[model samples]
Target: MIDVDVLIAGGGIAGLVAAAAFVAEGRSVFLVDAGPGPERAATEDSDLRSTAILEPSIAFLTEIGLWPVFADGATDLATMRLLDAGGRENAVRTSAAFAAVDTGRPRFGVNVLNAPLRARLSAEVAQLPGVRVRFGCAVTGALARSNVNTVALDDGTRVHARLAIAADGRDSRLRKAAGIGVRRWGFGQKALVFAVSHPLPHNNISTEIHRTGGPFTLVPLPDRAGVPHSAVVWMERGPVAGRLHALDDAAFEEELNARSCGVLGPLRLAGKRAVWPIVNQLARRFDGPRLALVAEAAHVMPPIGAQGLNTSLGDLRALTALTRGAADPGAAGILSRYHRTRYAPVAARMAGVDLLNRAALAGPQPLRDLRNAGLRLLDATPLRRVAMQVGLGAPQGTVSGKP
Candidate 1:
């Protein structure tokens, strides 16, 4: 039997962040993951698919001491450009300047590929004396008592810890075993992510363009071999996208160009394409007696605006703070506390994203005009700017430090 202060299930972003946070607080952290395979990698160089770290969220991670390790490996996105298709307006543009003025931050956020970030986190965790990691280990069983959590491994060994956390993906086995259920639905769309080089420089600008089908996100990457490259998330109707993905590179790019409306002045494919069938999901129950869910296990938003992992990190942060560097193993009160901390923000964001998506993709001309006007007014007015800041995860009251 193995024992530790905390037992974390799933070694993805949320689990790693939670493990790292507790270890930094001098808590013995043990992580168990079924293990990651290269087949899941977005590109050959990165084992992680793709994820964006938001500004404030990055600050939180920095406070926990994980940012420096990622500095050299991540890309800083200092500006954002939002385009409204079938409309005529800039609506809003946010820059590091605006963020510094509005929130007193130098940069809003940094974008990093998953593989390197994951690797650095793994390496850093390995160096921490309080952190223990077991890859290639699957949990065959789990039991949470009032004082601790016991997990049975596939190999017949049992491990005990003060708490067991589920951060595995949306369909979390740990969550299932703990009686957690999630509401999941296919968005009838698929997002195809790949790297593309453009003749025009992205200029540190990450962009989101809304269309009838869905949003197309273009995030900047470093200049590669003197070519300006960007990471693209082109979302389209699932049936069409499935057929598009099955085609050869030339055919896929042709279809992608048709979807993008020549935004980047002709996109030249630079990496392997990865496709995700879009879905919106959230857990029915965030926790069981001793088991708690974070990240995709707890809630999953559509990939719009980098909500998936960011919300996951938020859950991790709150869980760490509420747990206060100690675990009663699978304590229900602690689990409830963790769930409560995450419930509001997670549910709010889920509804908000769904609303935005539905509104942005609405077919009715009148509703589109109303949403567009609201979108425009929100950006053009100071009152709306503050509201936008709050919607963007700034502290509830103000961007000032008092909160």
Candidate 2:
């Protein structure tokens, strides 16, 4: 059997980030992923993903030395503009200035494509002194006891660690192996994400224009061919997305441009469009015995308001604090405190995101009107703004940014 301080069962963004945080603290950590992740492509590469890096998430990553690597290749959104579209009289707009003045950051976040971020994170983890990643090794079995965890790899090797990190993603194998349960809810909506090159410049402002089906976001990216491009998360309700997915390029493009409200002056499709089912999965408990859940393994919500990866980054930050001063990386006392502090914050964010997504995606006229009025009122009030500011900075533990 092999030995390590902590054994992680996934090597995705959350797993890599958590491994880096522990390695930076001089802890011996082992990361095991079923297969190597994909590499980044040069121009307008979608590879089916994108995530927003919130201001506090950026600060936490920079503190742990992961941001520089991610930033080296990431697309920056220096500003963010929220535009209400459902044909409402308010037609409100909010910018980074709205989130930053309260949070003390220049911008609420930066938006970057997934492939580049993953490629960069993989490299950063490789260079960390104490992180050992074993790719192409699937976990064949797992057992957790009070003092340690034992995981068997398909390669016929066994590893024992004081604790196991479940960074395996939304449908986490490690989480299931430990007998942890989750509450699952589906949005009945699928997100069509792709890149679009528009005639007009994005002007570095990421826009979220809500429609009947759901929010259609145009996240600005560094220009390709000197024509401004943006990453789009086009949420479509029910069978419409499925039918559109089956449509020929010409038909699909026609329908897509019509929905854009002429904001980008005709959307020229770039990169392959991909669809993902939206699920809200929250582990009933984040830790059990010698195992702790991280990232999507802990909780998941619809991709509304820059929540997914930002929430995961926050998990890495909180997990880092839970293990900060322990002589042993996976001591039971440390793990219990981690479960305690992390549960509330993670759960709150999960619930909050779920609520926001439901409100934004509702079909009825009264519901849509109420949501729009709420955003407008919230934007106009000073007391509510300060309250949001304080809530945004609240952290689970030492390393800030979880919720």
Candidate 3:
């Protein structure tokens, strides 16, 4: 048996981040993924989604030495603008902009395309002496024992480690093998992800427009060839999204522009469109025996507040902190503490996001009116700042730019 401190299954961003964090703590790690390498994954047209990395998560990556490389291709998020168009012919009814300055911070967060971020993390992990990344390899099975957990790989290799963190995404083999059940439900909505170039600058602002269907978000991205650009996540009902996806480039661009409400002037497609169904999931247990679940393996929320990956990063952060200096990485006490600390917050956040999504999709006019009114009220009071702080998942009084 090849012994290690941590054996991570699934090679997504969360998996790679976990490997880097564990190695930074002087633990040997083996990471396996069935997909292509991060660099290759970045160049693929199918993986065009971008992530808005919160300030706290950026700091964590910096501590582990992965942020510098990712920073090169990232764009700052100075403000988050929310527009409600649910009332009256989908026109902008009410708008609120949450600025980092309101909280005495320079910027709220930054947006990075997933492919480049994955590429950088992959590159960094390859050079780390204590971490090994195995591409095109999948975790076929797992067994949790009293002292350690064993992972079976598709390539006929076996790994024995004090703990195995499942970052394998929403459908996790390790979680299933560990008998950790999850609560999952599918939203009839589908998200269309792509990049666009605009004549006007985004000014580092991320915009989310609420309509009868769902949110259409435009997140800032670094200029491409001197033209302003932003990544777009347009969510609609499954049938509508499918019809839109079939439109010609020019037709789709027109629909996209209208949905965007011309916030950044005219828009043109800069990347291929990728679609994914929206889902909500939360594991009943974060850990069992010598095994622990992190990232999507633990929970998955809709793309509403950029909480999906940020929540995953929270999982990594909590797990890394709990395991530090522990004699047995997989001690039941450590796993129990992780479950206690993480499960509630994750569940609460999931519920909150679900509520917001449901409100946005509410068919009743009275309900929609109430939802918009609540948002306006929040914006009018000090609760706006508090809400922004809570949404960012940062502690109160924590400055954004501080390391």
Instruction: For candidate 2, write residues 273-301 as lDDT tens digits.
Output: 88988888889888877888888888888
Q: Pick the candidate with the highest lDDT.
A: 3
Q: What global local distance difference test value does model 2 have? A: 0.75
CA displacement after TM-score superposition, residue 38 of candidate 3 (Å)? 1.9
Alpha-carbon shift of residue 222 in model 2 (angstroms): 0.9
Misplaced by over 4 Å in model 2 are: 40-46, 88-104, 383-403
Candidate 1 CA-lDDT value? 0.72
- Clash counts for all predictions: 7, 0, 0
Tell me the spans in candidate 3 whose CA falls farther than 4 Å from its real position: 395-403
Tens digits of per-residue lDDT, candidate 3, 1-403, equal 5789999998888998899899989999999998878777777655798998898898898888888866878899999988887776767888999888777788878898888778877888889998888999999998877887888998899899899998998999999998889888866999999999999999999998887677899999999789999999998889999999999999999898888778789999997898988989889999888888999999988898888888898888888899998888899999999999998888888887898888777667887788789889978987786777865667434524422
Predicted candidate 1, C-alpha RMSD:
3.6
**Which candidate order results from sorting by TM-score in descending order?**
3, 2, 1
